[model samples]
Target: MPFKNDERELTSAIQAIQRDPTLRLYAVAKTYSVDHRKLARRLHGMQPRRDIIANSRKLSNLEESVLVQHILNLAAKGFPPRMSIVEDMANRLLATRDALRVGLRWALNFRAKCEDPEVIRSWFELVQNTIAKYGINNADIYNFDETGFMMGVISTAIVVTSLDGRAKAKTVSQTPNNPIKAMSQSTFIKTRIPRHQNSSPTSIYAAVNQFTKGASQIMHQLALLKAENQNLRQANEVLSKRRRAKKTRLRQGGSLSQQDAQDLQDERDVVQQVEQEIRASGGRKPREETRARRCGKCGGTKHNARTCQIEIDTSEEEGSE
Candidate 1:
């Protein structure tokens, strides 16, 4: 409904609802003593109260400081604070405007030091503005980006209410809290290609699009391609492992002929040869391992990460001590 009211003529909207053949049944069951025509019209335009979107953290001109202090004050009193502790101070009564100022100021001061952090830069905003100004579709324009994907199931929120209706709690999973992974995959950009190369059939792959700036740009491009190639390689390894595991399972009750292993090795050699030729054509640097991981079995290196045999929860063990 509009903020202001003009009740001159019960709108056409009211007339429509009243005249609608279907609403007659519902309207008959529920009605006020008021005139039927007016009541029907009012229901047509009635709108529910809108809700505001709540965010964990926001830019600190002032209120940010206050919220931080509120959280901190709650923490000091041995109560769990509702607001995030990051870039915030502990202060009670932050919800009230008057009491939150001082704590907010302290938080603002601390935040100033970390103001230039990469996460705060808002890359999406920068990209938008740059595209608007430079026109992203220009012939010479090239898009560049870096990305990472999840290796584990990331945890999210769920509210658990007690049967008694007196207590509630939330929990987190062992996975890391990564904003990029969540936003990119869960939101509109459902699929991602780390980086891509433009290739044509007759000219051969990477035989297209040479940079004007010579070696420097070419080196950077090659490095990006290498990284993308490495990501593809890891995916290939994972796929191959899955295939091998599936084959192993299928052959569990059966015996493998010597020819089967030889055939597999032959296929692998063909793939290796093709990859070598592709790399030779591109003439780029090799891809490097992007992940840092510890061995699961006896803390030893070089093994399958998923099958890590160590069953200890180190974080829990430390807390217990």
Candidate 2:
């Protein structure tokens, strides 16, 4: 029979047998609900089939992780990739290593890993945290309903509405060329109209809505202003502390600290270098220092053989010749 329990249960069963000498394999297997034979095989140092399959997979662990992350990122951005896209991505990654392409339905097996309970839970947590972080309101969130029509059959229809009536505007279907053709279905596009101002309920609701909106806006603005003020105060405190420290250091006959002085000097040097580069007329780079010329005869720097001050020993050269 196929292994009934997962690798973890089987491993636990094997460990249980090993830990207690008196424990029988069947008893431990029964406790973990794993096949006794599989447990025995694992105890004998035989690796699980799952591990073997994982080792034989086309993508390595790290590559698979990267692919999963990429898929998740696309999903978070409201553009979930299709199974074919996943297959193509896997093939691209494999191609980088000059490996053979994955087989058909490889994406199905890959999707199984991403569909784990833990992974799904994490996805929900991520969305929840994001919503909470942004303080999103339920009223501000909207649901989208998508509809499609036959491309050639759809014709532009005029939408008419009365200014005072409560009737909704709708699309009108055009007559088809063939008399036998059935008339296409009409589509309704609802347009919101203001209720009668004389209605007490409507007027009360409008007033309440206006007041709530204004209050919410005021609260939001206050929150923003409070945060900005806090930041500015923090910045001011930092600047004041720095100024005091600088004065104290100056009174002690010291300028900036060693590291600070070095950083300032480096900043000045970078600014000077940038200024020089910017002021340069052409696209030419800064001129490099010229290498000093050496005299071949006298072996002296800054002068070549033609400009050497030392006189040559012509007598020895003539005798040798």
Q: TM-score: which candidate is best?
A: 2
Q: Tens digit of lDDT per residue, candidate 2, span 192-211?
A: 12444465465445544544
| Per-residue error (Å), model 2, residue 160 | 50
lDDT of 2: 0.59
- Model 1 is weakest, by summed lDDT over 10 consecutive residues, at 153-162
- Model 1 CA deviation exceeding 4 Å by range: 1-45, 48-177, 184-321
- The 10 consecutive residues of candidate 2 with the worst lDDT sum are 183-192
Which stretches of model 2 miss by more than 4 angstroms?
1-198, 207-211, 236-256, 281-321
The TM-score of candidate 1 is: 0.16
Models, CA RMSD each: 32.1, 29.3
**Which whole-number lDDT from 0 to 100 does residue 196 have in model 2?**
42
lDDT of 1: 0.42
